[model samples]
Target: MLKLVMMNDALRNGDAHLKNFGLVYDDVMRPRLSPVYDVLTTQVWFPQEVPALAMQKTDPRGTEKWLDQLELERLASLSHCHNVDIVQMQAQCREIALQSMATTLDECPKCPPRKALEHALKIIEGALPVPSSSAKT
Candidate 1:
């Protein structure tokens, strides 16, 4: 769920790739989702693409709104791909994700992207509980 949100932001910001992500494992040998990897691309890559979208914009606010709408669309597709409820799971995940990204960017200055993702994973871990140790055993 969190990964979908981060990926939505990444797609919105135009940073899509595996290098942007990492994974961790739990006691039950399951993989855990990481925070946001490769976010710097937004700062590094977004400006070049902006002028194209900007020209289509009749109103200044349209550009920002367009990005938000794009994010939501991507979230829906992603949710479907994962076989989850788009509105209930993805929407809620995106809301939590926005907050997670804001908090990571603010408090974790100089934190490595992997580290940031680890933090984000921790946050979502509670919301989407992992399989229990007993279940795994």
Candidate 2:
């Protein structure tokens, strides 16, 4: 759940809401988070899109609202993770997003132009909360 929230913020996917998440059953009938799906860069189209059903509220009259360090901290606390964990997760999500989006932009034929997607990726990257390299667990 933590990773999903972080990834949604990192990828600037404004369509991630409770309904988008589901539980998948294991062989023992234990349920776990289903693989993330329906992810769309709604901000690329709407530009003013805020996170869907995020914990924090966005100002109606304001521009796009993004999760920041404080929100990350709050999420971490709720998930029982340390600050260092959030930092590492954020870095991992950013790296994964960059690589995956690169492949997507290169291979997707029906998708928008590479340049436009690249611009959108830049916006997503810009919104990530920068973690300190020197921070330790």
RMSD of 2: 4.4
User: What Cα-based lDDT does every candidate model obtain?
Assistant: 0.46, 0.76
Estimate the TM-score for candidate 2: 0.76
Q: Which candidate ranks first by lDDT, i.e. highest? A: 2
Worst 10-residue lDDT window for candidate 2 reads 56-65
lDDT of 2 by residue, 11-45 (tens): 78888889999988885577898988998667777
Go through the candidates in order and give the clash count of each: 1, 0
Candidate 1 deviant stretches above 4 angstroms = 1-11, 26-28, 40-83, 93-137
Candidate 2 residues lying further than 4 Å off, grouped into runs, are 27-29, 56-64, 82-84, 108-115, 129-137
Measured with C-alpha atoms, the lDDT of residue 81 in candidate 1 is 56
Residue 14 in model 1: lDDT: 46
